[model samples]
Target: MARHVLLAGIIGSTAYGLAGPGSDVDRIGVFAVDTVELHGLRAPRESYVTTRPDVTLHEAAKWCRLALGANPTATELAWLPPDLYETRTALGDDLVALRRAFLCAPRVRAAYLGYAARQLRTVERRLTGPGGANPRVAKAARHLARLVAQGRQLYRTGTVEIRLADPEPVRRFGERVAGGDLAAAYRLLAEAGDDLDRGRSPLPDRPDDEAVERWLRAVRAAHLAVA
Candidate 1:
């Protein structure tokens, strides 16, 4: 039978929503799959874990969900420098399949938005509370918060990721604010809704790109595997 294991990974500059000047260093990964295990479905499958204070299986599952949604960021994550991933008795094809469903952009954006909003509040409180206030520090603190708003849009609509404005588009817009600019930012982040739209536009043509190909391949493989 075949088996696979999660190894090191690099989320690197990937988590725009989680980023800050002194934000937590993002992570990347190395996963390994056994070819023999790939060939057999009845293999004892216990993966080896290097473990990190930062990475968790739940997050991995979350990534899978977002990727399945066709979220670009999540899709990009599954591909790290090959050196980081080491495959032995693992299911390479299976891992690819998981990434497909994991790329569910819509859901991932929602979850990431929540996380980013919370982080923004945490920083905001520290600066505005009585004995503290540094403009430069606060400016750096605001990046991820804004990105969260922007990312939410890109993820939902499948737009694109871009660096947000410095220091303050609008205060309290991080999580509490609803509608208007905040809402627009979220919509703009995931611009995929445009692609999925089959009306009033180019009437749906097939895409011919490596990223699209890889995603389709993974999803098809997964569906077949499941069936």
Candidate 2:
């Protein structure tokens, strides 16, 4: 499974330029199974997640489906900076080139904002639920900020910036929220909604399904040829 990885890259805080001391090095990858494997009654696993090394690998077809829906975490793999990549084949390069073909206005808007909403719930839980002042409250807050900002940028420009322009501000914002400034977090979330509502995105209303299909077929063909 590891050997079949087509594309994999560093992601999360490290790739976002927000890592500090003790931050985990997270990675995401795309892999392919032999085409013949799909002909059987049982299908091969489509995803693998590990906590020790903090890595996740998704099969090629599954990855394409998630990317087409504008899933922020899944979509980041194709947009990661060159230096962040640990594996890159010709097939991987093709996937990266088709990254934009996966974006669409409604999905981008819905998926990102929806993800941000979930992060907001986590922030509320960590802040008000169990232990007082959990450090994860800050982490959740930071991600909440990142998702909104990144989502807004993606909606407006049709591309995601993996590295933050100024991570320090976001870090500070997180600290402030962690220190019981919930109002600020709410404000940021509200701003995210407003930004989404105000834009006429350059992205089409839907992803380029034909392009994605062609690319997925190419991946399967490549795997079959190699096998």
Candidate 3:
């Protein structure tokens, strides 16, 4: 229950303002120890709060043949700022190997770009262009497109840097909605926009189409490499 609540909080708080012309990916994880292994001297490998940076949880996931290579969050956490987490156990070694396993050559770049393009096309035809009423949908679309750029950066550099910080971005997105800055508010009085459209998104008056396309290419290339 706690884990679910935490995940929801992260998503709900950041999902709105975190976008651009596309949506954003919200990644998270949870780990727990086993009860059967906790017999007398043998304790299940327990996760605990670590003395890290802005991150709050850091635990070494024990690497078993069945468990090691499939854990994406475990592998990703290893690359966070040193202050955020630390892992020197045998399991950590397996995770390092898994990173190499998930990466492909340059082909992943095309896949990510294709994925973002599909999304943009879908939104243009269905949501943002004609009769769509989702106030923040355009911003969400922008975020998704830019993420393609962030992903490409990851692939070329072999590093993942989180752009959407918590709380602030989300709140700003909501504030735009509260201010009635959506397409639906176009005809309302400037002062009346806030009262009439209480749940709108506040994207820029206009997002540059070229910027969205370019960002998608850069981000897509990088996302594939973040094992």
Candidate 4:
């Protein structure tokens, strides 16, 4: 069956306004499977990832699951700026409009900080491992900072800010951490923890699962109609 992409958008360093020379242009998207395929004896693939163009397209149901869990990378699709979007169907627009339904305090805090922990490990490895100054480490450090800032924004304002207002500071921080200053990375992470602990956020304690279910039903219905 032909895959139908409902939404696709530029993400990663480019979306955050932190891309440099030779940076990979990453794109992520959501696609719908025919409703009938879901009942097949063999389950259809839920995700398609290609490195040639650095794109990942998730099945609609899978995308909803990840977003509902506050997966930082997955949630980016729902909050991308208009220009960053490469494709947006009517359903895609609806999904974007309902992004707030997927956010919750506990999941946001856990997912962001949990992803940051992985980046922290990368920073630590760069500090002690050979080739400490490799560009990937710098990228990881930058992502570490980005995740914390984005997470904070979502929790504090109930809105996601994809592009950083001041990206130079994040770049500088990455450089510092990649240059063997693990303490700098730790300090920033600690501050993020503090904010999550003390911040009075506008987000709810639980996500609006009913709204997500309604949207997913719409997606399935749309696919079935076309089929």
Candidate 5:
């Protein structure tokens, strides 16, 4: 069955206001296939993609499951700037409305810190190479700092702030990493990760699964009806 693109938005550096003149435009979206495909012998694929600037389209059901888990990347889509939308149907707007329902303290901690850890590993690997510093090292440092900031903000405010309103901390951390002061960078990441356990975070312990499921059902029903 043909795929139906439900929502598409700019993501990555451009969406986060970190893009430079040479940066590529990255996009992420959610799509759905005919209901029949879900029940047929061949299950629908979980995602679609295009090259060039890079676009990824997640199948609707898959997108929901990821969002329910509070996957950082998927959840950030809901908070994108109004101008970044390439496509947004009524159903897509409904999906965006449910973004906050997916926020769970544990999930945010895991996803954000986990991603930061992975990036740190990448930076560590790059540091061992012949060249003093690579572009990826700087990029990874920025992402790690951003993830930590976002996670800390989410816990404190119960909302994710994709574009850091105050980027000084991340900027300083990035500069340290870029200048080969990885020890300082690691310390900052550790401090940020530890903050997740401080006091009682404002975010909920788990997502509102019932509400999210109800919304998903409505979308599926509406699509099936049209199909």
Candidate 6:
């Protein structure tokens, strides 16, 4: 059976407005199949892919689960600019409408900061390893800085800014990290974490799970009826 592609949009560096001349265009999407297919002898795959520019499409249920957990990659897909979309059906519009339903201050803090911390550790390891300085460390540092900045904005505004609206400061911090200034990188991460720990965020502690569930059920029902 043909997969129903509910949403498809640009992601990665291009989606973030950080793409350079050599940057590859990356895309992600969500697709849904009839519920019966999921309950049959062979379960539908959780993901699909296409090559060239590179697109990774997750099953709708799987995407919803990841978004609920504030998986940065998956959640960000819902916030992409309208012009960036290559495909968006009514179901996709509904999915995007519920983007805020997946956001909670605490989850954003954990997801963004935790991912940045992992990047920092990777950079630290690379710095101490025989490879010395490499482009990967600099890239990781840039992403780490971006994550902290994005996390802060989300906590304060309840919305994520995928592209760095102001990239200068992050650019400078990335330079420090690239120069082997691990101290500065750690400081940035700590400061971001501390700010979030203050618990001053105006966002709710948990997402609107009921609303999301209702939407999911409606979508599944519509798909099943047509199938």
Best by TM-score: 2
Question: What count of clashes does model 5 give?
Answer: 0
lDDT of each: 0.40, 0.91, 0.35, 0.90, 0.80, 0.83
lDDT of 3 by residue, 7-115 (tens): 1112211332354344334433233233223344865443433322122332222321111232223334433443333333333333333343333323334344444
For model 1 the TM-score comes to 0.39
Give per-residue lDDT, candidate 5, residue 53.
59
For residues 6-87, what per-residue lDDT tens digits would candidate 4 score against the true structure?
9999999999999998889999999999888888799988999999789999999999999999999999999988999999
Question: Model 6, 186-221: lDDT tens per residue?
Answer: 998999988888758877899889988988887788
Deviating ranges (above 4 Å) for candidate 6: 49-52, 225-227
Model 4 residue-pair collision total: 0
Point out the higher-scoring one by TM-score: 2 or 3. Answer: 2
Local accuracy of candidate 2 as per-residue lDDT tens digits, 1-227:
45589999999999999998989999999999988888889988999999979999999999999999999999999999999999999999999999999999999999988998898888888898878577898998999999998999999988889999999888998899899998898889888888789868999998999999999999888778435
> lDDT tens digits, residues 35-69, model 1?
33346758423322234444422222333444455
Best by lDDT: 2
User: Candidate 4's error at 159, in angstroms?
Assistant: 0.8
Each candidate's TM vs. the true structure?
0.39, 0.97, 0.36, 0.96, 0.93, 0.93
Candidate 4 vs 5: which has more TM-score? 4
Give candidate 6's whole-model lDDT: 0.83
lDDT of 2 at 3: 52
RMSD of each: 9.5, 1.1, 16.5, 1.3, 1.8, 1.8
Candidate 3 lands at a TM-score of 0.36
Better of 1 and 3 by lDDT: 1
lDDT of 5 by residue, 113-157 (tens): 888888898888887677868777888888888877777777778
C-alpha lDDT of candidate 4 relative to the true structure: 0.90
The reply for model 3, stretches above 4 Å from the true place, is: 1-27, 30-101, 128-130, 164-227
